[model samples]
Target: MRDPAANNGRELARSPREPPSVNCRLEGDPTPMQVAKRYRDATPESDRLPAKKARLLSTNTQQLGTENETQTKKTTLQQPEPRRSKRSYASFLDDFADEALVHRRPELLCTFVSEWLESVESDREKHCRSDSHLHPSDEQPVARLRTRSAPVMVKARDIGGFTVPPTPSSTGPPSFRADLDDDRSRSSSSSTANVRNPRYRQNNLRFNCIHVRHATSPLPVTLSGHVDSLRAQRSSPGLSSDDLNQAMYRIDVLAEGCDEEQVVKLLDDTVFPDPEGDDTFGPATGLMSNSSTLMAQHLVPADGASPYRVTQPKPDRLYGYSERTVGGAFTQSQLLAQTMLHDRNPDYTTATSRGLRFPFLAIQFKAVGGTRGDLWVAANQCAAASSACLNAVHQLNISLQACQSTRRVDNLSYCIAVDNKLAELYISWREDSSNYYLQQVDTFVLSRPVEFQSFRTQVRNILDWGKDARLTQIGDALDVILEENRKNAAQAAKSRTSPPDDPAASAKRQKPSSRRNSKGSQSSQTQICATNPTLPEAEAG
Candidate 1:
């Protein structure tokens, strides 16, 4: 029933006898749907870039960040590198662009850009000092390089520039690869995430970026200060500050084909350019440790701005603070600080809340007189104390400064601490009624009024004394005796029972000898002769 003409046309299309132009419409000049499908397929591969680049760009000095990198998700971080006093970014980029164009590393070239015109994009205080070593995959084709982080200001010269060459490689270090083959495994963008144990190896890294721009018109005092503080410093191990110097040389080349107005236009075009924009420069990240540190420098009262949200942590766990007191600080930086604060439960008073009964850390203040017991003077009186016989002096002090309290008497303070590497345990406890103790219920609570002295020592001692406090020694709590009692009940019941004896054996067969039997009824015995041949009369005494 089909038309011959239609059949012939379909056959022609499949047979490869069709014209090339028709084929182009079907495949080459893709429809939006086809383009979208390709993009979907390409994304996994796209995510691979950061993983490879992160491993690639990191020096031994930068490697310490690797431990945290895997646990975090992609986010933008603001990195406002101090700009050099006499440097011109416009001139520098123009020159850098010409060289990259010559070399043709389009991927890197396109990403290096200034999107400042589009508000650029809402895009490291040190603790310890140590040499950093970047670990590579054990499966290799390379060498190792050792490096360390040091602070320095890069100087931007006041001149036209030339091309800067790539610094020699610093690939010597240890061996470390994310266990997950796909480094981009953590693509989920959730507000909260469990902080990874530092020992875990993560392939996924949080990618953060930001851009900076300044006017070419005239130099201002504030801008000068910014530039002077932003330059790269020289290191003896790998690259030198001169490499940044050479970046200026490339700027001269950027100025070659263009005039001042054109340079301005280029800078303007660079702002928020499409994905394919020029790539000599970009919003650099990991240029500093994290976004919060950057924000504190920019938004904190001293950083010269009315308070703003510019530097807040990305809405994810890897870069967050646990305590509201620590506020929006990065979780890593706040770990130690957070550890020092009072936990959700200061005591086992609320058996239901975590940390209640979980071991605490005690810091007994020695300054207050022993008799006054530290908190007495602070609270101003003894009878005024809240709990009877409660030497309980709960205070809230950070760095030993007394936190104000409405409590008129002995207000003691307490805090917990953790290991220095931002490694910590958020100890929480749950009362298990199914087993023994009442689950946050009224039963089993000691009859005595709550006492604070024993209380203060209790939690701190648990953590301090550790498992020893929790260990069940013989006859400790009555519950152990009760368990033993149950088992004994079954054993006692079995031992007390006995079986009845059988009556049938030989006695029933001997019934015929009745007359000769020595026994007789009580009346016959009284008569003394009926049942037996002779018997003495039984007399009542």
Candidate 2:
């Protein structure tokens, strides 16, 4: 009898004595025998199928086992490789722990500054320009006059000068108070009484004089009357109208003595002062000096020699305008520059004759409240300071070149915002351009709890970090971490969008018999079986 497995065409082996080869062509559904015949035909003669039935059977079993093992190996090789673990901020900090410690050391500040200076010097050629044109100067003269109804008389003695006395009211200018009847009556009565009484001699009359010290000069002088009266009395008897006008213009009247009306008229007619060609006559020097002093106080030791120094021809005093309008024209920081940096001289124009030192660091500090308005003001102040530093550095560089100095001066400017809860530090430098401009290097925000001790420590740490290279490293590390997080989020989103393939699930779906029937179908089948229990037996009969 034929083997059932052979009839079903499942066995690949046959008697070796019957045939070593069989038809390779497939009919209907190909059998294992047919598949074996194809494999035998494709192989080399030395590797041909075995002739003996037992040997063929053993060979087929070995070949099938080898094929299964190769398929397993292929599937394993095609599997995806595992991804590398992402780094965390904590691990990054640990890697550079020693460098962080080095950066925090106070002793390294000098080294950092030296390195920064060297870098500036190396890049000097890029910023240094051949153009010698000065910045377009903006000079706003402060208005010093105060309005008053009555004309105030400043004695000549107060201003440190002598002037001719008034001619006993007879030949004086019109009285300031025209509506006063007493003055008119006195003038008429005195004239008549003086003429009637021959004992009253004009030449022997004694005059009252007031002595006052001058604002600018230390010397004192005596004045007989009002400056206008003195000037009227001093006019020549034969002088023409034009000549008298010229003489009045030449007369040096103290600013304090000028009437409100006269002051307003002068201001309306007077032209603004021309821009000072040299730095000597303008307010720039004073402003620069004040700015420098503020910087030195915060950045350097009191006795230590700083790499940068602020200079004005007269560092001893602020510019005239600065002194006159201290609080009005400038901010508290600017006023501090004027008053704290130099001696409080009433004379605004008085200053040290010495010129500014080269390579100075300019600093400006602004106090900001938590209010939005204060923040806006602080921002503007910083911007203005940046512009000033750029201009100053450009001028200094040009001056150095003009003097043929070997030292290359680079202007470094800093703007600091001080607040109880927050602090900001900004670094800026001049850009190489025909017009003066400043470029901001960086802004550091130091945030912490508003405790004084901790806040102060935080500020110091931020400053130190800025000076060292660690700040840049930390920034880079943060950027990398953020990028990795973003990539991870994207991969998660992609995975959520596409469902994973399941081979077992697909096979179960294709073969209905492998899946369990729904509840409704199962209930219906049970009911039919209960109602017709003998149906299967009747069909069998």
The top-ranked prediction according to lDDT is: 2
Model 1 Cα displacement at 407 (Å)? 33
Write candidate 2's Cα lDDT for 206-267 as tens digits.
11010111223321121122111212322112334564344335222412243323322332
Which lDDT tens digits does candidate 1 get at residues 1-541?
3454564455446422111111123322442223334555666855756755565466554666775674453353433357854323233343334432324344333333432212122211121223122323346424755669655845443334433454435544333234332333442321122223221112111111111111233334543442233222222122134633443343345433433333223222321111112231111100001111111111111112211111221110111111212221122322233233344423211111111111122211112111212221211111111111111111112212322222222121112111111111111111121110000101111111122112222332322222232212111221322333445666677656743444764466566456456455544565656556455545410
**Top candidate (TM-score):** 2
What is the lDDT, from 0 to 100, of the residue 462 in candidate 2?
A: 27
Model 2: clashing residue pairs?
157-221, 314-351, 314-352
Span of 10 residues, lowest total lDDT, candidate 1: 433-442
Residue-level error in angstroms, candidate 2, position 149: 7.1
